[model samples]
Target: MQPDPSSLLQQALRELDYGQQPANLYDPIRYIMSLGGKRLRPLLTLLGGQLFTDELGPLVKPALATEVFHNFTLLHDDLMDQAPLRRGQPTVHEKWNANVAILSGDVMLVRAYELLFENVSLPLLPQVLRRFSQTAAEVCEGQQWDMNFETETTVTIPQYLDMIRLKTAVLLGFALELGATLAGASATDAEHLRQFGTDIGLAFQLRDDLLDVYGDAATFGKRVGGDIISDKKTFLLLTALAQATAAQQATLAQYLGQPILDAEAKVQAVRAIYDELHIRPQTEALINEYFQAALQHLERVAAPAARKQPLHHLALQLMDREN
Candidate 1:
């Protein structure tokens, strides 16, 4: 039997060399990469390329670039958010120091570019780099908007959607587009693949928000309601805020405004509000909307249906994940 795309990506990651001299700098990169999650972005890259061709060798290094870039973002994001854990291990900032995490994350970003430059064909390099650069900047912009939303009293759903699109979805888009483009997919098919990724990315993030509150603690891989405790402006919180009545609003404010409280109590109180507003169903509804949209775009891609099966199945699996 053939090794799966995920197995190929994982083996490549294991064999990756990030230099040995600067143990501190390189070790953290290795550590964070080893402490793994789904590796969804890079896998999408491989799948996108596979849609166009059976040869996945050329896609591996470039696909690895997506994972490197993603981990780089997580390293810095953990620092910025003061998150203690990632994938249930001590975050880079916690295991090392904030400075180490920051510098290591910077190196990972540069390394991601290096991987792309080394692997991608010269003919496609400029176009790939352009899209990657724009995606990187948009990710930063999205992060900025997310931080700003925390302080700003009024954040509309559209604004929140756009923020996630930039911060989370665009990178996913670029991963698929990169793979498709590198595999010689036509421009139209590549765009459709990008859109497919973007839509799936949106749904993925929203599902995360849903699971934070609703997922079982054992399988969820992290503490349920961590988002609520932190008061991160997720879709669930934002939607509940929008739909809440004057009384419900006051309750939400009282809980959210508290500087110090029992963590579980806060989660319970906030979760009650979410329950009252039927936020779970609403969030699921929107996730379904984006998911269905993703399928529509996938259908638009000009690949043979047989060739598209792996990606289609992967998308379904992503939507079904509990963690």
Candidate 2:
């Protein structure tokens, strides 16, 4: 069976609080951890660890490391994105200050290592640290690429996919692989687990693109049409650009770079064109293709079905979530 979100989330919150002090740093850490996210990274780590064995006790520390790394990214990302809010609350930078946010984020990164490096076997520590470092740098590279995309008018669909894969998906891949490694799974099995995560991450991002325009307002947390408002270069938009007629293309071009345009009207107009082009279904089909590919990679692993079943179910639930 899939894990319940409420109880699982609570457990993760409690885990986040263990062995922490210094109210300045710990307070912000506690606030952010308690704010609530999908906890997908940690959950994947736990599941990945389970592929080698059913016991979860020894896995919690490393699994928690995955979450710490995830939050470290979010902390810096909010600063970079100039995002005012996270989980419907003030972001660290917004609630405090940029310098404080940056320092706190650095501490979180250190804490991630503290948890990760503590119990890691000395022989394996070097490889684990290397993987973590590579993953962190790649995530930063992905973010830089994402920021670059904001100014570029002509990002190809393939390029966009690669960007998201590095920015969002690789971390998920790392979470799974790291857990598998900690559990002493064969390298081949760990590699397969990583591939599974990468594919699912791609699909998850594509589904997020679809949901930004089409999801129910209540479940979506933030505004449903923020992507359209921001004129983000999502798969749907890129595909629409590729498919639009000359007049439609011209219409879209006029609104994209202009500062004086009405946000809502542009959203509606672009959405109307997207509807006319059947973009929503096209995007959904693409998402499903990646999801199926993810499952295919998972199947390549030699582990028993029972060992992987929970993760399989979790993936399905994430794909089907209204939020």
Candidate 3:
């Protein structure tokens, strides 16, 4: 019998820890992975693999490779963003030396591939490896673009969308496609699954941007308005830029570009302008647009409805989540 999904996740977590050398490195990996956020990407991949076959034995380890890889990115990202905490704990770089953090991250990538190719059929393993490499490179390109946007004074909506497509969405799409391929889905079906993941991932990122500025602080898991405080070029900020009036433009310029401002006051100020321009509703509408597109692709996949229902519900939950 196929292992239960929850059981598979647990088993994968266990397998990830096998064969660690340095206790220091191994302990931190355990610590970060144990911090516990929604393990959505790996779960999606496992679900994707199971859509074609009941056998999860071959899929669980590779599916978890995605999660490990993702956390690796988070470790490095926290360093780059100068983020003090992750999931409410000190970031790896903060708790350990930067060189150690970098070295550990490299090990995580190596382990991701080890898990992926360990039991994979040799004939098909190269193909999986090549595809994974391409996806990994694309994710890096996306991150670079995201960083580039910080120095950029002006960015269009389309450019922002494309940037996010690479940075945030491609990995999600690749996760599904990876699972589908492992399960022997037809290439076309795998592509459809990938498209579904990409669409939903885009929507998910947009929703996060929305929640960062507007969500309730209590339920948001982190402080609301972080993006606004950092002056990050979120979709909402772009939309506000597109719609602001002369006075609104001056206000935005004065506050968004200024330093040494109060967090709560800045949040309240920006929100007042967002309200004036109705940017919140407009952003919500755009988020709905991507969700609809994702649903359309999901409905076209050649999988059984029963098998896809859980993933569909998961997509909905992610799109609607506050945190």
Candidate 4:
């Protein structure tokens, strides 16, 4: 019997050797990888493959490639955002330095490609590379758009949705598609799985936006309202802005315009706006929309229901939709 996805990935990560030379360059890579997360992307890859075939051994390296690339993005993202922490620990740039973070993140990208090229069958290599490259470029585009939104005052909900889809959802789609492709699933089936992943990814991110304001700081693994304090445009904030009365708009603007205010006061003020506007339910409704769409796509995949159960359960669990 194949090992569970979590255990399988843990063993693979433990055995990965980044080569010890100039500890500074390689150390950050190891450090970030060791900072545990849900390991969701790679696990999706494994589950994607399981939908088509039982021999999951060959999918391990490619699945790891998704995880490696993901962390590489986070490493650089932290640097760009000037974030102090990741997974509740000092970020790479914080622990080391910006230069180290940049270089190490670059190397991580190279290593992700290496992992992909190492095990992918030659016949499948071109297709895999093309998909991976497109996804990588889109992720960058999304990040750039996110940064642009910080300065641009005209951002819209549709634009925001597209941004998150590219920035966060596409990688998830590609991960699942990669696994299905590697496992010899038909292109049609693979695309269905990809759509399922993309939809789930959208809901996952929207849930994150909701959690930032309402979640327990300890469970959320970061300070609640960090987004509010920064005036980072999230779905909640945007929705509230759209729905607020002129008086409410003035109130929101009053709090948000302050160059400096007590962090708690800012959070409370913004959260009060969100609460009055029913932004929580609005966000939750949108999340459910995407989640239900994901399930529809998952149902369309040609695989047996039993084979698809793990992925379905994972999707439910990730979105807190599980009964």
Candidate 2 lDDT tens digits, 249-273: 9988887877845777887888988
TM-score leader: 4
lDDT of 1 by residue, 32-65 (tens): 9999888989999999998888889889999999
Q: Ten consecutive residues with minimal summed lDDT in candidate 4?
A: 314-323
Candidate 4's residue-wise lDDT over 1-323, tens digit each?
A: 75688888899999887757789999999999999998888999999999988888889989999999999999999999999989889999999999999999999999999989998999999999999999999999999999999999878999999999999999999999999999999999999989999999999999988888988776776678988988889999888888999988998888775785588888998899899999999999999999999999889999999998899889878977221
lDDT of 3 by residue, 1-323 (tens): 65677677886686566346787677677777888777778788888888898987788888887888888888777777777899889988888867778877878788788878895778779988888888888888888889999999998999999989988898899889988888998888888889889988888888888888888888877778989998999998998989999999898888887893588888888889999989888888988888898888778888889988878888878876643
Give RMSD to native, each candidate. Answer: 1.5, 2.5, 1.6, 1.6
Compared with the true structure, the alpha-carbon lDDT of candidate 4 equals 0.91
State residue 90's C-alpha deviation in candidate 3, in Å.
0.9
Please give the TM-score that candidate 2 achieves against the real structure: 0.92
After superposing candidate 1 on the true structure, give the runs of residues whose Cα lies further than 4 Å from its correct spot. Answer: 1-3, 321-323
Better of 1 and 2 by lDDT: 1
